[model samples]
Target: MSVQTEINLSQVVVRQSQKWQQLALGLLCMASISSPQYVWTLLTKPLLARLDVHLPVLQVTFSLLIIFQTFLSPLQGKLIDRFGAQRFIGIGTLLTGASWIGAAYSQSIWSLYLLYGVVGGLGTGIVYIGVVGQVMRWFPQQRGFAAGMVAAGYGMGAIITTLPIANSLASHGLTQTLVEFGVGFALVGWFASRGLRPAPNTDPIPSATLTTGRHYTPSKMLKHPLFWLLFFMMACMSTSGLMVTSQLAGFASEVGVSQVVIWGMAALPLAMSLDRLTNGLTRPLFGWVSDRIGRENTMFVAFALEAAAMTLWLTFRHDPLLFIVLSGVVFLGWGEIFSLFPATLTDTFGSQHATSNYGWLYMSQGVGSILGGPLAALLYQTSHGWVPVFSVAIGLDILTALLAVVILKPWRKRFLQH
Candidate 1:
């Protein structure tokens, strides 16, 4: 072989290795930050016991966490875009860890609200949007699959910690567990953040796979009706998913299945662990499917699946074994929005200013958190059952599914035409 050809092959190998390294680091950073949200349901009983609060009032903490995480993402995204990923992500992870450590010492619910809700939200928000937006820029050719992998880390990261945290809550108590794990997460995430670098400059792949070839800034994108439609659809999807996420443990106990043993393990933790697996799996699964079938088509299928799974879940909720299994199914149908929406957004709006644009869209999840976390709890308090809450979620899922196909696809096509 010629020396020139060998040099070219060597460069290709180096590039491939670098890409995978960045991907792995991004995944680690995502997983490191996931626990505050994903494991929150597990924390509720202990928090309620410690704080002596009403259910809806306690839920406000969760709403605050998500509200801050998502609401501030635009500003966070802009900063990451300007000052670079490593500095912001490092600071974000430290804040996230500090939130947990502070929560460990917090005696009052209000203090917990400030520490776990506001601080944790800001920290995780910076890491979450920063990492996902970075992934969007890095893998322009494979945004769906790449975003899915990192989002999967965030979705499924809790699986490893759920059992440990549950066991710790049983033995060591919440305070010790929070401090120990918080420190570990902070260190690991900060170290991983150092490894992240901006995407390298490359010539645009001519008329790349599905992108509109027209870049839209956050300001320009905000004016379009289609953006609002997509926002509404995402908010619906987020509401369904976050409702289950934040309310799972509460609803299980309410239904008298929380303590029931399924396969020698308590049903709630088993369901939560399984839900994480399915949640993580679905991001990539649906993302890959969307790459082939188109985003709206994939949305219709996944959203309909969630609606159907929710119906079965609500129907057979009293059966502990079925409850555990269907919770996974419910998430399987729901979690892909994390992957699909960002990919679709970058595809439509263009990757220039992708992070900032997604930050604005990410705020929709904050809306879902409010509706799903506090309002849903209040609905339960008033209605005296889980049926009403689940029914509303199911309706949103079906409506969003229909909108994806009937409205979004054609509207996007027309918008792109001009």
Candidate 2:
């Protein structure tokens, strides 16, 4: 072969290696920022104990974290796009770490709300959108799986820290645990950001993928009825999932299973760890399935699964063994929304403004956080039981599942045909 040809082949190989390396860095960034949301349940008991706050009042912190994480995503996405992913992600991670450190020293509930809730949410939001958007561009042919892989990192990252945080809460207390984990997340996420670059847009999409070749700006995308349908569907699913996520520990205690031990491990932490695993696994698993079976079909299956698991969970709330197993099942169904919605959105609107477009859809989670987090707690307080709360979640899950296949399938098909 000619030397020019040999050099061309070598450069291609290097590019392939760099793409995979970027994927790894994206995963690390996601995992590093995951703890704030996932581990909030574990911290609630400690925070309540330290601050002597009411349950409904304390739940606002959870809502604030999600609200900020999602509601500001459009702005964050714009900034990441204009300024570059690496610079913003590194700064975001540092802010995330600092939020935890500041929260550890907070002497009042309001202070915790600002530091842990607002600052942490902003930081995680930057990393989440930046990494997901970058990776989506990196592997256009395998968009579902690549997006799923990093989304899984966020879903599952807390598995590594759950038990450790639980132990530290038991031994060192909440203040110390937050400081240590904060430092670790900051360092790891910053290091990962340094290795990431924006994905170039020269790669072609395979003909098999049903993508709208037109790139729609966020404003145009918002005017379509189809976007509203997707927004509603996501908001419903988010409400159900975030309700369980933010309120699991409190709900477990209400059901008399919080203190139950299975296999020498506390049921809450054990169940939480398993839940994280399944939550992470479902993103990629369902994402890959959607690639073949179609996104709406996959959503129907996964959302239906969550509704079923939730029904059984409420039925057998007293069984600690079932509690641990079923929580994993619940998450297995719900977590795939992270993968499915983004892939579907990008497929429909095109990737030119994918991050910004998804930013609009992601705001649905903030709506869910409000309805599911503090408001749900207030509902529990007023209704004087958990049944009403769990039942509401079940209804929303079933509603969303039906919408996915029935309304979404036909509407999206017609929209894309144009």
Candidate 3:
């Protein structure tokens, strides 16, 4: 009954509540990421077949999805800053569920474009920013790993859904399968979005007081040369990865691989899942390394590995084992960028508005996604193979590496001061 004892009990209760909130947020993160992948299997083929559309035109729907996400993510971030997470995620989830169901009944390509491309993409954009921003807020001390875990869910969700959706499409027909996906997404997203609430009375923690003394405002961070360099680095990195992801099945077919084998290999979702899982685990480690060794140093290693992996693919395209190994490496390196970039943003820009700032940084991924497939397709058409295409990708990796070293120099002193 003592006043001191009451204070201690209140503190314990607060800590416990925060822990449960974090747990719920993490689960929400996983569900938010996974929901989109339900449609990946039907991205081109099933829809194209059912709707009787040309491949190129059908692919435009995919591009529209990326375009929507690209243009809307920053806006969503601003909304998150204004309204907080719970409301944004809840409304977004509702829209996303409706879009998916509408997509299932599309009688024309334009309808698909409207439903999946515009509505679904916009819905995802809102939820994506909400979940990721909330994670960063909840785990300011572990932003890199926290952000990576949420982002990784996006990749891993695709992996988890690929086989099941593919199987469903094969057996149940596209419309039914999508209908089921819509229902599932609606139910899960509703519960998950409702679970997302910000930690009470939390303020942005400055890195200076912590082990890493780096922070910047979005406007100020934009002034730094290194921010643009890192931004472009991520853009190109995304271009390379998405090119491969979107074209994996086609690539297998072009190389004279069997349909059964191609379908089996299409399970790059396994590789994708591993890539994301590794990213979640390694992000904090790399952040620690960046804190210790330096961000540029960590980036140098990532770009080098990425370039090397791409080279392996070019050299041994015929060997399935080598292809898978190289693909895995490529995905792993891609995950590193996702893991490191947000932390780098936090380091360069102040955490006062880190969520919004990083959201703009993430828009680079949408740009890359928009360009990646089309670029690869165009290059493949012109070159008659992936050889030329991958060569260009390698060049991009090299360019990113050089830029990272040059642009990050000014921050080197600041980083070392820590």
Candidate 4:
């Protein structure tokens, strides 16, 4: 073979190796950050007793963390783009871990808000958006599947630690558990963050698969109508998942669902365990499907499944067995948003500024947290039932599913042409 051909093959091999390494590192970073948001449900009861507050009051912290994570992401994204992922994640790890340590020592509800809500939010946001951007840049060809896997890490990462955290709250107490795990989260996240680096630059492939050949800056992408539609759709999707995430433990107790035990495990913890598995699996599973079908097509099926799952969940919510099973189904349908939307946005707008562009899109999740967290808690307070809340979530899920095909697909195609 010619020396030139050998050199080209070597370059391809090197690039391939880098992509896989970056992907794995991103997944580890995601796992390191997962417990803060994902396991917040397990901490709610103890926090309420310790802080002596009503449920709605305590939920504000959850909303604040999401708010900080997402509302500040555009800035965080720009910084990551400018400074590099390693430094960004290093700082994030310190904040992420320290928030838990701080929360461990916190005596008041307000202090928890400052620690987990504000500081933790910023930390996780940096790592979350940064890793996603890395995945998109590395696998422009398989953006959906690539983003799905890393997002799955965030979704499923808690699986390994969920039962342990629950057990610790019972055995060791929340304070010690938070302090110990906080240190672990920081060390693990920092280790993973150091490995993160941007994908090497390359010319656009001659057979490029991007629907739009044009690259839009974050500001321009925000101005586009399609972006707003996706934003609203995202808010809907996020709300459904967030409501289940933040309110399930309390809501289950109210209805006496948590009292029931199946196979010697409490219903709430068992459901949470199953939800973690399904949530993590759905991202990559549907993302791989989208690579073959289409983003909107996959969105339709997944969102519809969530709507159906919510419907069934509400219908049989009184039954602990069905409740645990359906909660998993709900998460299975909903978790793919992290993968699909970022991949779709990168596909639509090009990866030149994917991190920043997604930063703007990421804010919709904060909006969902407000709608789903404290607000949903308030709704339950007023109506004194889960029916009204579930009804609203089911409606949003169905609406987004329809919009995906009817609006997103055609509009995306036309936008690309222009």
Candidate 5:
């Protein structure tokens, strides 16, 4: 064999190794950012107590955390596309960890809002979009599964921390818990992010790839009807998940199970841990299914499953055992948006401007937060029951599931054919 042949083989092996290494690093970075959003419900009661703020006002801080994390994603996506993933992820992680530590020392409501709401939102948004986008670009051949694994980091990462956070808050107080976890998140995120790298995209894709064999810039992608279909579909489904996630503790308490022990564990914390695991698992599971059966097909199954879960949850919600079990199913059905939609977007639009294009798609999450968080909360208040809130979410899930086949499948085919 020629010496040059050996050199080429070595280079290929090294690049493959680095690609997987980068994936692992991205996963850890996402995990570090998970607590701010996923664990917010745990902090609300304490935050309200220390500040003596009303529920409606305290909920704003939570809403803004999601809003900033999502609404700002399009801009952050473009920035990641231009500036690269590692830098933004590193900086976002620092701010996210610091936001917690800062919130631990808040002297007033507004100060807490600024630290946990504004800073937390911006920081998580940057890292969330950056890591997922980077993964999609890196593993175009396995876009769905790759995006799922990274997203799973965000969803599942909290599982390891939920019980710990609850225990910490119970024993050490909220302030110490925040300070200690914040320091840990900061260090882990910083170290992991140092390994981040965007996969090279120099090779031309084949004409028969899942994409349209044409690329669209973020601006051009907006003009296509297919993008809007995806945007609305995502908004509808996102609303269902976010409503449940944001209000779990409240609803669990109303059902008289938040503090009830199930095998020596508080129902709410145990539920949170279960939900996180299912949420994390669903992303990759459905993403892998999408890679084989197609994105829209998997969406139909997952969305319909969530719709069924919501209805059952509402029916048996008064029963603590059913509530805990059904909540995990709901998450398993819902969390794949982080996987499916981005993969679909790249498949439909091409990956050249995937980060930027997906940014716009991600903004639907912000929209969902508004509808899911405050509006759903208001409906529960006015009706003085959870029926109305769950009813609305169930409707959205069903509609989105039907549209996945009835609308998205046909429209996408036409879009690609043309």
Candidate 6:
């Protein structure tokens, strides 16, 4: 072989290695963002006990976190588009770490709000857009799977951190635990962010897909009816999942289950772990399924399954076995929403601007998060029961299913055909 051809092959090998590195980085970025969920239980308990706050009041922290994610995502999306992922990841990771450290020293809810809710949430949002955008760029053909893997890391990170955080809280106080997590996450995330790099000009496949006639800017996308329908569907789906996750233990107790059963239900994290795993697996599976069966069909199946899961939960509240089964079903179906939406959006608007579009799509999740906590709290307070909360969730899922069937059908046909 000619020396020039050998050199070209060597360069190709290097580029392939770099892409794999980027994928690993994307996974780490997700893990860092997700690690906080495990810490949620720990923080709430200690803050309420030590600071003498009530659960309802302390729960506002979650709302603040969601609100930060909603507002910060668009800004992070724009930054990633202009400056690329590396700088955003670096600075964002640093801020994430600093926020943890600050949280450790927090003596009041306001201090925790400024640290955990604002700074940490913003940091996660920044890294989130960068990692997701980088992964999508790396795997244009396998966007769903790639997005799934990245998102799954976030879920899995919670599983990985839960035991450690739980153990740490038992041995060390909250302050010390926060310090450790803050420093560790920052260091790990900073190194991981270093792996992100802009796609080379030669990486032209995704760009070509964009040029093939369907492209919509953010404003243009908003003008389309399909976008709002999907947006509301996403928001509703997320609200259901978040409500269940945040209130699982409380609901279990309210149903007259023993304290032992309540603690056993901590196994809900294990369920959530499974949910994340299935989420990663399903994205590629569902995305591929959408390619064949159609995106609308795939979403129809997902939402229908979700509605059934919620209904089952309401019906079987007293049955542990059935509740577990329904919980798994709900999480699996919920996972599909995260996995499929990006692929659907990319198909509609084109992958060239997918990160920004999906970033906005993710804000719907933030909106759900903001609403889920207070809504569930209010429902539980007024009804003095869990049944009403689950009932409302079922209605939302059914509405989402209807919208998917009617509105999303035509949108998918128009956008995904080419």
Residue-by-residue lDDT tens digits, candidate 5, 219-286: 89899888999999999988888889889999999988888888788889988999999999999999
Predictions in order: lDDT: 0.90, 0.90, 0.67, 0.90, 0.89, 0.73
The TM-score of candidate 6 is 0.89
Which pairs of residues collide in model 2?
Answer: none
- Put down candidate 6 lDDT per residue, 1-418, tens digits, no spaces: 9999999999989978988888888888778777664347546778778768777677777777767766678777877877788988888888888888998898888888888888877887787777777777676666666776777676566667766776798799888998998898899889888867886644235432222455577778878777887788889988887787667656756664413343355544444444545545555566566655666778888878888977877787776556666777776677667667776677667656666777888888887876677678777988888888888787887888787878777755655564
> Per-residue alpha-carbon lDDT of model 1 for 186-216, expressed as tens digits?
9988999999988875534644245646788
Task: Spell out the clash pairs found in candidate 6.
Answer: none
lDDT of 4 at 230: 84
Candidates, ranked, TM-score: 4, 2, 1, 5, 6, 3
Candidate 3, overall lDDT?
Answer: 0.67
Q: Is candidate 2 or candidate 5 better by TM-score?
A: 2
Q: Who is ahead in TM-score, 2 or 3?
A: 2
Please list the residue runs of candidate 3 whose C-alpha ends up more than 4 Å from where it truly belongs after superposition: 1-20, 35-42, 200-226, 258-293, 412-418
**Evaluation by lDDT, superior candidate among 4 and 6:** 4
| lDDT by residue for model 3 (1-418), tens | 9999999999968866775576466555455545453345345677767889655566667667767766677778877878887787777777777877898899998898899889887877777777767776666666666666666665555555556776787899878877787777767767777766665445545454233344465677678666676678789877776776666656755764324333355434444444445544454456556555566777788787778887987687676555656667776665667667776676556555666777788788887877666667777877888888788778888877776677564554464364
How big is the RMSD of model 1?
A: 1.6
TM-score of each: 0.97, 0.97, 0.86, 0.98, 0.96, 0.89
The prediction achieving the highest TM-score against the true structure is 4
Separately for all candidates shown, the number of backbone clashes (residues 3 or more apart, or on different chains) is 0, 0, 4, 0, 0, 0
lDDT of 1: 0.90
Q: What is the lDDT of candidate 6?
A: 0.73
TM-score, structure 3 vs. true? 0.86
Question: In model 1, where do residues sit more than 4 Å from their true spots?
Answer: 1-9, 203-209
Tens-digit lDDT track of model 2 for 1-418? 9999999999878878888999899999999999999999999888999999998888898899999999999999888878889999999899899999999999899999999999999999999988888877787766788889999999999999999999998999989999999999999999989999877665445444557468888999999888898999999999999989998998899898888989998888999999999999999999999888889999999999999999999999999999999999999999999999998988888888888888889999999999999989998899988899989999998999899999998888887776
